[model samples]
Target: MAVPAGVAAVVREMQDRLDAMPGDSPLRDFLSTYQRTTTAVGQAITDGVFADGEWVEEWDVVFAQLYVRAYDAHIDGGHVPRPWRIAFDAPADLPSLRKVLLGINAHVNYDLPQALLGVISDADFADPVLLGKRKRDHEAIDGVLASRVAAEDDELTATGGKSLVDRVLQPLNRVSSKRFLREARQKVWHNTHELQVARLAGPAPYDVRLGELELLSAAKVADLLAPGQVLLRLAVAGFGVVLPPAA
Candidate 1:
């Protein structure tokens, strides 16, 4: 019921499961990217990059378990969140980038707030010393994630395989070209703060708002992957090839 072995072990388990999946399985590409990204962040935690490394290691395990549980449930014909439902049911031909994005979308938009609440529910947010450390450590993850994404550019492009579109967009690897990774994480922190406030006000209202957030985020993912959004999707993909930010 728990990922007691921690983030590194959880990532290894995911990689092993991914390896055993059918070669053409739609889930493989996304899981591959996820595993790589997670491993990079896990290394940062292992290196004591965060102010409260133990807190981060524990939080990472808890967060990963959500995805692990959802994956198992989907495999066993149990219910999962709408975003995950879309991901698990994806057609084999869905683009590699889309698969990666869909997984990110589901985890950050739907699962992150809840995970944050679990990890920090008892925190005294009004205490500047305690709150500041939490915030510092939270933001520290962004740089770790950004660097990891950049380092994996070649692997990510290779995962796209030999499609003309993939080749054409090869130069535009988003991981290198844009600040999307950092911004997405920042938004997750913002959302988690909002959720914590709502939950503090009242559990009933918080439950209602959580449902609303889930539906809204799921709808966004659905729209992003919709067949009618090809041109828009392409434009989004094109952003990856745009120039990297200046140092």
Candidate 2:
């Protein structure tokens, strides 16, 4: 299916704004990566990469709407999704990459599963063949993610000069980034299934499960920004100090 018009407009607006920002700005870097991923997903939908390309396009729009809400909230000093609250609340001095990762964590871990259900019907879950096809398509985005991240690495390194810590993380990131995406995507599937099960049980159970997912994401973000991790975050911030600003 073609990319939804609404999704296209949202992405275009984001890309335009990101284009207008200073290249070295943390928000610009975050939105640059986000825009590239959205563009890839849009192309994938147009190319019929998913068996249910229409559903995939709808899911992309639903997922992006949540980000738009969070971003607007951040700008207007209004409420945001709890996980995104952490990202917006992060210290201004935090490393640019970490800022981007916080947004990724909130969006993927917190918002993706909820968005998944919005795209597929409860009946769609019953067809094993169809389910498998949708899942395969969902999982295939890992390639898109890997490519986008690899291409963005130079910009990240330029923004924050690599440190010993970054070097140590390099081999691990190369090995584990796709693995991480796969695991995260799998968890989203599982969460969607669990919510479906809970819905059959009762509203109370469904609500509780949803709350648990939100709490889990909040705790994960807390760990990411926890005091124990401060030194590493600060180190990355310091890495950029000696480097000249982006042109």
What does candidate 2's lDDT look like per residue over 124-170, in tens digits?
A: 88889888887887887777787776666666787673455665676
Pick out the ten consecutive residues of candidate 2 with the lowest summed lDDT: 238-247
Q: In lDDT terms, which candidate is top?
A: 2
TM values, all candidates? 0.83, 0.80
lDDT at 135 for candidate 2? 86
Clashing pairs in 1: 172-240, 172-241
lDDT for model 1 comes to 0.69
Clashes of each: 2, 0
Clashing pairs in 2: none
**Candidate 2 deviant stretches above 4 angstroms:** 1-7, 16-26, 161-164, 167-169, 227-247
lDDT of 1 by residue, 1-247 (tens): 2222577688887987887788888887777877877777778877778998777877787788788888888889998988788877877687776677677778777787677777885555667798778878878887877676545556756655335765565555443334655655666777777776677779886786677667766776676577643334534642111111112
Name the best candidate (by TM-score). 1
For each candidate in the order shown, give its overall lDDT on alpha carbons. 0.69, 0.70
**TM-score for candidate 1:** 0.83
